[model samples]
Target: MDMPRPYRSVLYIPASKERALDKARSLDVDAIIFDLEDAVTPDAKVEARDTLKAALKEGGYGARAKIIRLNGLDSAWGREDAEAMKDAEADAFLLPKVSSAADVEALAAIIGKDKDIWAMIETPMGVMKAEEIAAHPQMKGFVAGTNDLAKELNCRFRADRLPMITSLSMMLLAAKAHGIVAIDGVYNQFKDDEGLAAECAQGRDMGFEGKTLIHPAQVAVCNEAFSPSAEEIDLAERQIAAFEETEASGQGVAVVDGKIVENLHVETARKILALAEAVSAR
Candidate 1:
């Protein structure tokens, strides 16, 4: 398996705001999405595109993966946005409302195979076709757009997020099946640290690689929540040691912390350790 990239907190910065773009350079985020859609007003779309081009040209984002979220191909600004940023120093192009494999193919055609493509699975159609979209050769990741999904589903938002659970699960399954990263949607309440923490924990349990953030304030919390805890690291180390000892003795199972440790369990423990190492290295 490919080593997992540390994507604990992917922050979204509106391309239209120069100050926000400048501020992002100093933010401790795993990745920054320079957004040209949704965050940019329709009237300011062209200017935002120009601003993003210049920002990319300036090139000060260190280590943090730089991504550009373009308007949908169906939208008037989408093509121009992609064309303008084609040579920009970005790691990926995030396409909003991607509902099929063809969408990925079409985007790959425009952006070329050199850049990664992160698709937003926002609508009902997107969720339904997630597998096909994920299987696309050019797809690099999936970002769940829970707010738009809620609007499309006409479902009430709850603290537990019961209504969108199915859609989230489907996206996660597809991402894991295809070995691509799956990012949870943004938490609307940026001020609600408690709420954001809860949601982050939920997303981590649901197997999401990270959470898409709307504010820099949420970065630390999201990063901490997604990363393996110290206790978890210690436990994983113990599990690996125990499993190795047992394997040397020709035993198929080992015991760690009064729990049975098998090959599958050891594999999971190793992944946790690898994730911790990856995060620390970053």
Candidate 2:
């Protein structure tokens, strides 16, 4: 079945926070990730699960996708979370610390074909088997967990992200190869708007469809980063027009704004136009 691909801003909110859940219904984010894993304490897991179930029943996400990030499979509450969310009216079930294809298969067995599964590639083991994990037939997409990955690898965050760039890039490559959306990890420092913007730009350049956001403030930045700017849309239009002229068709390639534009460039332009339309509709 063809699934809706809302790979823009996936906003994570604690399942226990009724206020945040209520606010999320009105946000412009592509998805609302109701978190029942790391965000909820063990003592509150049951309560969070119940609250999320209730919210799901309320049905106010509008056009935005609805998702739930469950605890790792190894956790005590993982199975319970899956059971609770299997029919929670969510778009997908996010499995954290997805280390192997089996992890996804198990979740898929529970989720069945009704709900898609979004796997998190954060741990070293998960990174090592990202391709396999993403290859699962029921897998919908991937969300990079940069914070957990950095901690596991003991690497400091740098502008270049050299330490983990290979893993991050490989995750994106796997998702693309499997025809699934891939999202960059959340930027932890919400106060550093400049830094966050830079990372968002870098992620987009790295082939990420969008970004996982921690705060509502990060939504605007994520949306802007993944969106095609006015200048870019204009250039895409010119390139597409030039290509349709037939004069440039047999040329194999043509120069748009002094830059070589090819069939691949046209594909990218179409995606940009699609995103522009999606944004405009939203």
Candidate 3:
């Protein structure tokens, strides 16, 4: 099995801001989303595209996965944006407001199958059709756009996120079922470390691979939150060892921390260790 890529802190940098892009090179982030849609103003769209192209050509991202967020295909600059970045050395292309499998298929056709496609599950239709979209061969991940989803649902944002529970669960289930990574939406409040931490923990518990971030300050917190704790690593090692010992004895289960550990549990424990190693290697 392929190890999961660490996406605990996916930072979004506006393509129009050269200095921001420059600063991002040194930040300790797992991934960077060079945003071309909402972050770039209408007047600066063309300029942002040019700037992003030049930045990609320079190439100093190192281990961080480079992703470019494209505007909606219906937007004026969408086609041109894809054309500009088609040759760029980015990891994936993120399509905004993806509502159906056909939307992903159309973009995949335009961008070709070499690059991974990530869909934004923000709209009601997008949530409803998430399964079809997640099952697309070209789609590598699903990003929950909670801000837009909130607007579409006409629900108020709350710290508890009670309003978004169902939608988030749907996206998570779809991604998990399809074996694609599911990333939680941005926390928005960059200064609220406590709030961000709580949200990050919540996302992690919800089976999200990571959280999208709007500011660089949120990187460390998100990384720390999503990573396997030292205690967790220790437990995983113990679980694996016990399970193996039991299997050698012709048993199918073992006990770890007063709980039963089976083959499937061993698989999950191994994955946790694999993820930790992957992140450390990066």
Q: Model 3, range 21-68, lDDT digits (tens) per residue? A: 999999999999999999999999998988998998899999898999
Better of 1 and 2 by TM-score: 1
Q: lDDT per model, in order? A: 0.92, 0.86, 0.93
How far out, in Å, is residue 164 in model 1? 0.6
lDDT of 1 by residue, 1-282 (tens): 346679999999999999999999998889999999999999999999889888888988888989899999999999888888888889999999998999888888887887789999999999999999999877889999999999999999999999999999999999999989899999999999999999999999999989999989999999999999999999999999999998899956799878999889889998998899888888
How many residue pairs clash in all the candidates, one count each? Answer: 0, 0, 0
Residue-by-residue lDDT tens digits, candidate 2, 1-282: 123355679889999989989999988898888999888888999899889888889988888888899997788999888887788888888999999999998887776865789999999999889889888878888999999999999999887788989889889889998999898998889888899899999999999989999999988888888888999899888878876664535655577778876778887787777778777777
- What are the runs in model 2 whose C-alpha is more than 4 Å off? 1-4, 247-254
Clashing pairs in 3: none
Clashing pairs in 2: none
**Model 3 bad stretches (over 4 Å):** 251-253
Model 2 clash number: 0
Worst 10 contiguous positions by lDDT, candidate 1 = 1-10
TM-scores for all candidates: the values are 0.97, 0.94, 0.97
Minimal lDDT window, size 10, model 3? 1-10
Q: Estimate the overall C-alpha local distance difference test score of candidate 2.
A: 0.86
Which 10 consecutive residues of model 2 have the lowest summed lDDT? Answer: 1-10
